[model samples]
Target: MDLPRSFTIRESGHRIHNPFTSEKLATLGRALGLAPGTSVLDLACGSGEMLCTWARDHRVTGTGVDISTEFLTAAHARATELGVTDRVAFRHGDATGHVADEPVGVAACLGATWIGDGAAGTVELLRRSLAPGGIMLIGEPYWRREPRDQATVEGCYATTKDDYRPLPELLELFGRLGCGVVEMVLADQDSWDRYVAAQWLNTRRWLDAHPDDEMADEMREDLATGPVRHVRYQREYLGWGVFALMNR
Candidate 1:
């Protein structure tokens, strides 16, 4: 029903849980040409950053769902801080198999496609809640460069080379799934650093504060190895982006 405590601890300071920075998020919102009052449904919307910011900037109304109480608390605070509490709603629930009660102008599953098994099924899940001609936003990772060995695959957090396709193949996947890619905002190494490096600090801070805690040793190990793994593998081989799609 919730993310692991270790994960919450590692990302305690994050607003947006993914690799996207605030600027890239705003850019994606604008690229969608969201109209004032547009209705959006965001599945697995961590911390509700995209929803709250879009509510403030584009005047879009959205409902965000996540399984983390801690993140939901942060999301609610963000909404209040942004004066967007009236515009966005955060629900603590499983996003998998979640379909909007009403069709929405935008339906999204960002970086948690596992809710529907994978990209194709995730698109189908989102499509069920999308109004005709509405946009579907999917945040996913692709291979920026091919991994050369099983160790490299593990380093990128993939079980096998097929875990993620390259960018072109990913676009082709949308086509095969009856959607057309309309727009995309990608993450660069700098943004990736911002996301991954912050986790190290959070882990270190947590470990220092809870040296005798049961998970402290695990966090310490992660702190010891995470940066090198990220730099050598994920930073070089993985590409992440949020893509906007329309039914073809």
Candidate 2:
């Protein structure tokens, strides 16, 4: 609830809610080897960028689910703009236990892997939405290096010692879950900057419009310190990637 609203006000202007931009999306598209027609199921599909774009470009058809009414409304507008509203649709609902009515070739649970308890649980949940031999698109974060200090972790919003794992451990975790890492597209600092920095501009815009709104103070505080904290902590110590996995 808090996250969905934060996202709507923060990055709704972004064409893609994902970490990677057009470049990384291209890599993911290529890796998926999508044909002229491929179905996709996107869970935690904030704003529905992936489903809308894929439906337009690859002739895919599927459903998107998320908890945010605002996000679904925006997603619907995106679909209408892309002129693919007939093929793809968006629903406002919790993603933790929701599955597609029918199996799809691609079952995606992007950065919002916390949908099903956490990343590990989300992966298993996404699998259930895919048809046999279908792929699971998992977008998750990994540590660039094992964080040695709590300050670094806290800046990235982690307060626990087990919040994240290094790259090697992350890769192994997928393996232990019985998925073969078929392909992956990682996010560089440039991409992270795009994701985080863009938030500043959006937040500023929101604050401008809602100067007298109840959340103005919180927004102003976030705008003031977001960049500094991101640069000092998240950008340095954390790394993220969208991994394409298949059941082996």
Candidate 3:
């Protein structure tokens, strides 16, 4: 009932978890065009940043579901800190099959689409939570172009590329899934740097604290090489965005 320790301890001192910075998230929120008091559901809502912000900015109500007790605990603390606890709720459980208690004006699965296999499958699963004509928001990665080698692709992965798709095909896949792209906010190099580079700092902090831990060595190696690989391969060749969609 917990996310990996590595994830739980990432810097919340800044109050963000995703690659898209607060400014970028504001752009995303504007792109979604959520009205005040809109009901939103976010699956795999890491630390509940998006939901909390939406509640604060757009005055929306949301429910964020995640399997990580660690994250949920953080999320609740964040909600309290933001003074949006009354406007939003968080549930600690599996997001893949968990349905919302009520239909929502917006349904989202951000950065954790594997909860339903892939982008298209995740959209299908998220649709059940949406009210008629409600939008679906999916945050996922796409290849800027095809990878040139396995190392290039492996850099895309932490250790190996588990699932990857090219940009155009990803858009088409969503269209074929009975969706019309309403709007999207793509992540740029700065955003990518924010997401990947922040992990290095976290790993460094962890390695310092747990010098004798078995996994420390692996994390150290990952922290050491991750940025080099990301800058060289993944940053230039990969793209990610949160796409807003409507029923076709």
- Each candidate's lDDT (Cα)? 0.96, 0.84, 0.83
- The best candidate in terms of TM-score: 1
Candidate 3 lDDT over residue span 35-127, tens digit each? 999999999887888989889889999999988876777789888988999999998888987778789999999889889988878998888
Q: What's the residue-level lDDT of 184 in candidate 1? A: 96
For residues 129-184, write the lDDT of model 2, one tens digit per residue: 88999999988888886777888889878876477778778889899999999898
Better of 1 and 2 by TM-score: 1
Report the alpha-carbon TM-score of model 1 versus the true structure: 0.99
Candidate 2 — which pairs collide? none
Query: How do all the candidates rank in terms of TM-score, highest first?
Result: 1, 2, 3
Off by over 4 Å in 3: 9-14, 158-162
Better by lDDT, candidate 2 or 1: 1
| Local accuracy of candidate 1 as per-residue lDDT tens digits, 164-228 | 99999999999999999999999999999999999999999988899999998899999999999
TM-score of each: 0.99, 0.95, 0.93
Give the clashing residue pairs of candidate 1, or none: none
Please give the lDDT score at residue 24 for candidate 1: 99
Alpha carbon deviation, residue 33, candidate 3 (Å): 2.0
